[model samples]
Target: MNPNKPSKYLTLVTEESRVEGKKNTERNPKNLRKHLSSIRLSRKLQSGIDTDFYEKITKKFLDDFYPKKCNNPSCEERILDKEISTRPDIIRCSKCHRQQSRLSYTPLMGLKLPLYMFGVVFHESFLQFPKVITATEISKRLGIEYKSALKLKRRFQLFCSDHLPKYKVLTYRALEEEYKGFKLNPDTETDVAPKMGLKPYVSADACVLYSASQRANKGRSRYRYGGLTSSIFLSPKLGGKQVGTLVHGICIQNGPAFFESVSDTKANTIGPLLVEQIPYSVPLFTDSGYPWLYNIYKNHRSVNHSAKSSEARYKLARNRFCKLSVHNQVIEGSFRLLKSSFSSYCYIKPEYSKLYLDEFSFIKTSKFFGLDCITERCFGSQFSWEGRSTGAREATVVRIGQEKYPHRRSSKETKKWLIQAIKDRKYQEPEREERLRRNKEQNKYDLNSAEAISRSRKALAGEMKRFNDFWSDSQKSKHKRKREIKYENLSFKIWNSIQYYKESSEENPTVQFIADKFKLDKRTLMIILRKWLKYGLIQKRKLFNKESHDKRVDFSIVLKSDSLPHLLYTQLPKNKKIFRRMDQ
Candidate 1:
């Protein structure tokens, strides 16, 4: 476009024309020497392979072949100048053209660094690396730039609170070995009887699950804080040798202005929480600390050595349940472990509580199967009975999305209905004012109940005396069999029922009498009776005696009056002929 110079398109052609046309000037010997010398110098420069030189050559080549142009539609200015070999980062145009700098979109357009670095930082922080430490610390450890590390840590903390799984299962194994025997501390007088296996009761108590807490103190005293403690239920199965899933966990405390505290001392707090969370009519076996609770929830049973008569306690001291002190001790052990392992939980940091639980849920599951396993194994037979009897009840909303639809009216109405339904359907009415009234009345009436108390005391006294009489015989025998065997085997009658045989035309003995006779518990005897009756081991007929309460029965078993009655019980296990193993 320059007027004074040859047309830009004809420059190459015009030069070649001159090179061909000119003889002496164009083909001069001096020119030939200069050209050959230039070629040699170029070869020498190439021989060294200097990286900087190569870069320059590449820049020159790119400039000559391809003129850089502004990508911005608003700017028509070329990045390369008129001199094909010369180019500048900041280019200008005489036509009043504007130039816009192009941005690199490969690493998130307009970003100073790659987006991957952001992800990297977020990921590292999510892994819970130390945050307060300088970026240099991370750089030294991960071998990255301090700047990158710093950015990553900052961004990760900002974004990763909700994405991670609250809990994860690291590992688990079936706990058969720990279930081999009950945990009975013979040295401790506090322990109840050890029966099934050692682990029992995963301890969980109600507390504020989440709430605001006093973040700062005033003057000289600590500020009152708002916070939550979850109602936690833990059950140790088979004395904690075997564990199960988290059976039930309820979060009861919620507030915007106040922090709520839940303690074991709060009466019925745990009971209601348990009922809300667990879908079973499970018996809550506890220690003496919860007499009030036990008094209320009839299903709640307590094992108190102090409450027992001296002889009875002594007799039961060696019994499995009493000897082991297995009653509800596992829950206490779990509490100790939880407090020890998670020291942060000591004061309950509100914000970090859930985050802590995220890690804890996984760790807990890994350590002791699911939370429910702890409850199931600790409660054992009762858990099964409750689970079955509870039947298919209403399902609980465990997570947010389990609800199909969520809205204000629906939520409020549902909540209203739920609260009313829970109150209405409770095993007993909440008692509200009635409980207070009854409590006051009972306090006064306790005096008049002296006769009843005396009667109960006297009956208990008689029972204790009888138990003591039997206990005294133990020291006299050089080789005394376990007194339990006699009591269970009916060596002495259970004291209430007397057996009578029919002298006239009659039927076989009822299963109940046969069970009573063998001293087998009703449950054990029932199975044998079914088997005997199936094989026609006894005849069936109806009869009545003075004590008979209508003894018509599906006759199953008849004890041989001549056979050693005790042997029938003691040898029953050994003699396969007595009862066959039915299909399980």
Candidate 2:
């Protein structure tokens, strides 16, 4: 082959073929149908003349609010649908003369928008489901104010958040059908057997919603004067800051998922949350970062994403018999979809982060239950007007009011009342002065009494005694000295054990082995190992098991070259025997 020419392995494509491929991708029917459907829906909503949409929404409202029979016991007449058609908002019984407002006691109690327009907002919000439609887009489509559209959208999300179910699981047959060729059912009884007491595979992980510059001013003063002030300086790197809200998610394969905003990703925080959200019998899948899960759950498994090829081969062989893969890719892909849905918003505030998470979680749970977003389960019975009052509705509506002197008193009457009040105040001044002077004299006499003086002196002496005792150096120093001696003795014993291990075996000793030999707590030994590793006195190496072929991680401690010279020179009596046994 010529050195300058293209090799046989490499294939070159012309610009014409590249353009043709692009055209073919654009001409795909599925893509065309999606875009066209969205456009048609938006157009129909914006036109505001869809009578069928209005009728459908009105029928639903009537069905939710209409009583089965008339409220009057004497008549016992059933309210027919024809009698309810004159007014969409009010349902009337023809015989009993009873009337009811359709929106009363519901979420739409005092909705100001037209019935059809409200239907449009509802269709865009819940009917669309997982696809995010922002309030800005809704406002543009409905020709409404941005604040109105935002309030409408928030109301729907709040309803879903309050009513969404918890910990929904799919049937084994459903799971098997969805994930073909996977042995999800552990029971050998029957295909239609309930999944009760069976362990389902769950994947848990944490992800960031979005990142923002920590140095950015998140206050009203940033835009007070219509522009940024010169006194406030911002660094080019934004103070080397990247802040985001941590959200933890648990996803079941072909089933429901749960997400919540978390303050920290520590073991204590995540461990309790996982136990609360997931059942104890389920199998958990996560990455190697969550080693603590092994102790908490009985069926916990994880994959070493950062392992070398040899470690990966061992993991593969170890997990070859598992019913499900050992990776957490299910929840990882869920995080990607969640962040993509959140891309419609510029930024989500940490305070409102739970609402967004709950909204997404509700949608996922609804899909698992085979429920539509617009069904009565989400909108009708779940929504209430409890906290919302008539005053709140009145506050949103603008009205003209009296500008000045709205009270009953006229301007001349108010002046006369003020004069009378001033005269009354002057008349009582002399009596007020006498009373205040007498009280002051009484206070002075009380303070100078014998009992008061003695009480103050004793309190001062007690305070001084407590202060001296606290500041005394003898007690604190004695305790400090005792602690120092104890710590030094413990440190010496730990170092001696480490030196013994170094001499007895050619291979580095594992932390567990050393802890077992010295009869030390594993956590305390780990702390000491961490300190030694930080100081460069020892190095840590990951070793795999060849005897049992298990995937459990084992870390061995190796003495650094520079620190080996400083180890204890004393040798143990059993060192020779241990070395010979290891050589065998």
Best by lDDT: 2
Each model's lDDT: 0.32, 0.51
List the candidate 2 regions with Cα displacement exceeding 4 Å: 1-51, 58-83, 91-97, 126-129, 166-200, 214-243, 309-324, 372-584
Candidate 2 on 1-584: residue-level lDDT in tens?
42223332233445675576556559885665655554455444444445455557645643533233467887665653334556677766677668766654343445566566556655555566567778898788767799888766665455455445322322222333433422222211223123323333578988776643323634323232211111122232344122356688988654567887765455645776776666554567787667555334534566666554347445444443223346687798788888888888777665567767777887766655434323332322221112122322221211112211111222343424423322322211113344334423321110123442344435333433332333233454656545533443344455544554566555677877877766778665564565456445577787788878676767887777322111111121243331221101
lDDT of 1 at 338: 41
TM-score to true structure, per model? 0.27, 0.44
C-alpha-based local distance difference test score of model 1: 0.32
Candidate 2 TM-score over all chains jointly: 0.44
TM-score (C-alpha, index-matched) for candidate 1: 0.27
List the RMSD of every prediction in angstroms. 25.8, 25.1
Q: Write candidate 1's Cα lDDT for 125-215 as tens digits.
A: 3334212223564556444577666544433322222212211101101112222322222122333334322222322332223222222
| Clash number for each model | 57, 0
In model 1, the worst 10-residue window by lDDT is 251-260
